[model samples]
Target: MNQFTDKRKGMDHKDLAVEARGLVKVFGDNRAVDGVDLNVRAGSIYGVLGPNGAGKTTTIRMLATLLKADAGSAKIFGYDVAKDAQIVRQLIGVTGQYASVDESLSATENLVIFSRLLGLSRAESKRKAMELLEEFGLTEAARRPLKHFSGGMRRRLDLAASLIAQPPLIFLDEPTTGLDPRTRNQMWDTIRRLVKEGSTVLLTTQYLQEADELADRIAVIDHGRVVAEGTVNDLKESIGTSSLHLSIQNEQSLSKARLIVERVLNVQSAVTAEGGKITAPMADADRVTDLLITLREAGIQLEELSVQKPTLDEVFLSITGQNTASNTQVKKEELA
Candidate 1:
């Protein structure tokens, strides 16, 4: 086997599909990317989340070989990105924040062009284009011009074009930016499908729920550095606590329910009128069952109740002290 093949063969003991250390980049006087380290495993989705100007795009660009990092190193499946960029390119596909398809071309035409560029024969390209168009629910609109396609359809085509060669790794740079809720959900489904088929994906997004829903692990970046990195539960637990939320059937019941919960859990409960919801800190995991039994014995009828860890929005605000409201779904124009 060649040396590159040997290095990959040695990867049987390595858990990471992508690895980087002390990555940095600069644009004129601005340091777009600071020292950043990343380790993403094979066959899983890793999310990088941040607001605009957070260096997410710059980091991904370095990993994808579009831009070189000024310092440190990056590797994909044992291939060094800077040194073996061509080999690394052979293993990865990238879908940027903006749709990469030609606006005047048809969906099938776009995908076929991509497939052909990846070294597929014309006939093979056509077959692969047909398959991807069907997979991404674009078969009916396969022959339709890109201008006629909706924003969502075009986004799917961009994604479809990237997968033309079925590269094992994918870098999705804000894949759902500016998409409607339904269309974003559709894209989420497509991402899950990609992971199910054994693709490792690096996804960057400003949407908090997008990372919470899709990522096996997430790294939150701000001001060009990763402030936090972990699974959803891990990050939530870092600066926040889990809580029990209960809604009483009647407003009058909230008063009684609050007393029952506080007495049973040994914590104060705050009652809110919005949903007749009573919220309390959950210090002990086992007390949830006890609280339920205590409320039942006191004749409290709950309209709704559940235990929840803190949301990603809360974590983001706590870490950066920045208003989550200011983070809009950004386009490529907004990112560095």
Candidate 2:
């Protein structure tokens, strides 16, 4: 056995499918990923979330063996990422942020070509290609050139190509970034199917909803380090308190409503005149009924009132002090 394979055998199978310790990357003077660590459980979907330039792509590339880190170590199924890169490559598949499939080839041709490149026999390649096409609901248009396919179709093909070798680990970088809602959901279903089939996925995305929906665990990275890591509910609970949004009938009513909410709930409240709205965090859910009663008794008419949990977007903002979408756009521009 090769030295890489030998080292991998030393680790227990139940250990992480992918693990990184004190991972750091530097470009000139910029530290892309600084002191970051990750532990992705076998067959679980782990999401790396950040705005653009937050080092999410850099981390993914390093794990995929496309980039070497300046410090720290990463392992794929017990194989060192830097020292045993070849073995790591064999054990994982990567789908980059942008579609990498050749536009001139038909969808089936693209998958078949990749399967063959991975050392499948001609017949095996054809069979695998057809299977992937059917699995992704692309069999109807398998013979059409990729250039004619919609953004969603092309993305599905890209994912199919990555799985030609059926690698145990998959790296998906911003897999659904520009896709429409329907297409995006379809991709989510495909990812779930992969996990069900015992594939471990490491996904990076700018979409908070996507991460919440697909990831078994989430790590929020900023400025090249993980700022928060946990399940979606765990992260939300850490932020503390649920927000109550009230749309009062008029600006005057909004002002009164905010005061009442603050006084009765003993919490901070803010009122916006333009929207005639009052928003505040409620420490106790039991206070909701009292809040309504208090508002009505005070002659404050509310057009709408609702209590909502903090969304991932809100969590990102609270942790990083910036919006995830805006940061992602800035990073894209920089990369372009």
Compare the candidates by TM-score and give the number of the best one. Answer: 2
- What TM value does model 2 have? 0.78
Off-target runs (Cα >4 Å) in candidate 1 are: 1-13, 239-313, 320-336
Q: Where's the lowest-lDDT run of ten residues in candidate 2?
A: 1-10
Pairs clashing within candidate 1: none
Superpose all Cα atoms of candidate 2 onto the true structure and report the RMSD in Å to 1 decimal. Answer: 6.8
* 136-211 per-residue lDDT for model 1 (tens digits): 8999999989999988898889999888878899999999988999999999998999999999999999866788
TM-score for all predictions? Answer: 0.73, 0.78
Candidate 2 on 101-181: residue-level lDDT in tens? 989999988998899889999999999999999989999999998878998888888999999888899999999999999
Badly placed stretches (over 4 Å) of model 2 are 1-14, 240-242, 245-283, 288-309, 320-336
Residue 258, candidate 1: C-alpha displacement in angstroms: 23
